[model samples]
Target: MRLALTSDNIAGACEAVVAEMIKAAQGEAMPYGGDPLTEQVTKMFAELFECDVAVFLVSTGTAANVLSLAALTPPWGSVLCHPESHIVNDECSAPEFYTNGARLVGVAGEEAKISVSALEQAINKRMGDVHSVQPSAVSLSQVTEIGSVYSLAELQEISQLAHSKGLKVHMDGARFANALVSLGCTPAQMTWQSGIDIVSFGATKNGAMAAEAIVVFDKNLAQKLALLRKRGGHLHSKMRLLSAQMLGYLSDDVWLNNARHANAMMALLQKGMASIAGVEIIAPAQANMLFCRLPVGMAEALLAQGFSFYTGRWEEGVVRFVTSFQTQQADVEDFIACARDLSTSHTKTS
Candidate 1:
């Protein structure tokens, strides 16, 4: 079998998610999120966060993210985010388009996390300048682009600063489960309790096929987002399918179990790769994603050996490996063994 470690989304939908979808297909219910399944899923989210929340189900993380931003920011406003955040680098300006031209300001920071001081500077750069867009919201990526996770303390500090500056805090929780399990914190503590105003709660990366939710902590923003989602064309007519997937994912702690296993697999990879000569772990492997610096020859050899991953995205010689709920332990071991062999041969030749 090909050792696939490129992204968690490559994994097929878990059995529970598939079963839920099949079940939902058998019955005819209300359309356009007027169904009972959608309502139950909304309650599930509220309970998960330990507070009453408005949940908007969407088909993709990008939609959830941009819609949340659109609700929080106006056309003349600006959003502050880390330079390496998914919204800035990967979302293809959808946030800008959805907000009708809100600017995204990149704040420089280490380990893909925004520091409190840096965020303050960015927010205060032109507080009252008419020429510059006003800072309205700050977006943070949980299990950030480089695979590092922000601790609860870091999140609280940043959220506190943003709120003090009259800016809403939005978390792009594309790998939320992974980060949540890593921190061992409740969903509420990670979000609303940390002062986050909105969240793009993602399930597709974990196990669902194409389910994502825009979880609004503020009821007023939720009201606005309902219109934004409908306007953006993310309002699915057969919305029960998406709701079913999330229902399965969140039920019986399946999401948490899947994340724990994925994280464990990544930890194994991290330990194994660290012992290989010339393989440098470039970031903290806190969740299921890891970035490493590999020799060009080694990367090529692994690709030739049927190991699938990504390279040269962030920087030259850097590759990314992501584990999913379906990642097999044998495949991870095989990858490690292959890397060890390649490293030894290269060292001897050099």
Candidate 2:
């Protein structure tokens, strides 16, 4: 069995999501999210969020995030976010492209969660200045890139601060389900109720075939987001497949279940790694992702032994690991066992 500790995106579609896609494939879907299934999925999200909001379906997390920001930010505007946020570091300037030149200003902080003080500094540094990029909005990642989660209190603080400064709060919730299940909070409590104006609710990362939602809590922002999505070329034709995936993911609470399993397996891997030598967790393994540093050779050895994970540069001799919705306990144990053996071999050699 191959152990996977790469990214949640590496996991396959959940069976429920796949089955729904198959079911949708049999019908002629109304193009561009006009189908009844899309309406149902959007309604489910509004209910899950415990409020009336506008939802736009898209095919990728980048599209969801970029388009959501595009709806809120004007040209010559700037978005405040963590230095390591996916949109800042990984999206290849899709946010810039979508926002028609809105810039992303990286906030400095530990744990990959922006500190209110730091945000204040970043915002204050660019005030009343025509030459400086004006701060237009703030984006907070629910489960941050380092696998650290923002508590509701933390989100509230950030939200309050952003609003106080007249900046809209946008959440890049690529792992919204994982963070929700981890926090055990109602969707509203985690989002609009806490001052978030918009959210990029992701399904592709959790278990969908390929889908995400840009949810605008502010009714006024909805029309703009819909237009932006269409202009960005994300409006899907025969979009029922996308809606079907979300329908299955949310139906019967499969989304929560899959996220819970992924989180549990990460916990198991973390616990197992704690007992091994030369392994140190770089971040709290709260969600499906884990950022840990292991001995140099262990990554290579694990790959040789049929394990898969991204070994991000770990200083001089360490690497990172991740877990996903499909991670099995056996896979976790086997990877740990391999690490244990590698540790022993290294010790003997030294």
Candidate 3:
């Protein structure tokens, strides 16, 4: 059984992107994002988002998030995020560093989606107290750390609440396409129409090689972000390679197709795991990831049998299985079989 916890390891850049990169390497293009392909993808994103969006291409998701947040918040202001959000848990205070000491306050929520009431309370918790970090932004992770995505209604409620409180909304969309395919909503509905002010539109985690974008809905933020990206050393001189990958990713709805396949594989794995005697689906298997608890020792046994995955990374007593466009049906079934065999043997002994 073969499984990978991160998209970087599961599959390489899609074939389309590989071909584009090779083509880009053989040709001459303008440096520092002046190439035609870079300009074209920017237009493509605006069309897809159904609005005029300022798009900045970057090599990493962390840079995308930090730069976007830096543009929106000041050193003393705070950005709200779910406890398990990638910004809060994984980014190593880069948001604070990029924003020059801005704080990241955790908002409580169920299934990794921040709750509205908790967010409102947090926003106003230290409203005028100079001692506390004033809430200036709310960062949401689409297809959250535990794989649950906020529904369209849920996103709208949170965004509206944040905007009403004079706070901007940002989405860490590392798995943007996966969440989009899962929700079956248009890009505008999920972000700007729902009041999101900015997005770190991540394509690297899906199928692109080191391509991520910072998409700004607010023109004011976009203006500041341009300087920040260049000053922060994220601006690539040979930028067409990144642009080409994004172009390949978005063309003909390839991103949506890849997401659909990954989600379907997760659904298959989640369903089969649920039927096993000693397995527990720990979180909502909403997208291309699953968080489940196996019979004690089952995880170790499965690993011994050649399955590679993430266990106890997010929490103890649970394992994470991430499916990508490259995951095959046979791998899913074989994994399920391995778990069942261990569960059955453990049950008989007990």
Highest-scoring model, TM-score: 1
Candidate 2 structure quality by residue, lDDT tens digits, 78-112: 99999899999899999999888999999978889
Q: In candidate 1, what are the lDDT values of residues 1-350, reduced to their tens digit?
A: 68899999899999999999999999699999999999999999999999999999999999989999999898999999998888988889999999999999999889989878988998999989999899999999998988889998999999999998899999999999999999999999999999999999989999999999999989987768888889899999999999999999999999999999999999999999998989999996999999999966999999999889997676889999999999999999999999999999998888
Ranked candidates (TM-score, high to low): 1, 3, 2
Error of 2 at 273 (Å): 0.7
RMSD of each: 0.8, 1.2, 1.2
Query: If scored against the real structure, what TM-score would every candidate get?
Result: 0.99, 0.97, 0.97
Model 3 C-alpha lDDT versus the unseen true structure: 0.88
**How far is 231's C-alpha from truth in model 2 (Å)?**
0.7
Candidate with maximal lDDT: 1
State how far residue 19 of model 3 sits from its true place (Å): 1.1
In model 1, which residue pairs have backbone atoms overlapping below 3 Å? none
> Clashes in model 2: which pairs?
none
Looking at candidate 2, the ten consecutive residues that score lowest on lDDT are 311-320
Off by over 4 Å in 1: none
Deviation (Å) of 203 in candidate 2: 0.9
Candidate 3, residues 1-350, lDDT tens digits: the string is 36555443357788877888888888698899999999999999999999999999999999999999999889999999999998988889888889999998899899999999999888888888989888999999998989999998898999899889889999999988889999999989889998999998988877898899999999887768989999989999999999999998999888898889889999998999999997889996789888888888998888888888887665667888888888888888888887888899999999
Please tell me which model should have the higher lDDT, number 1 or number 2.
1
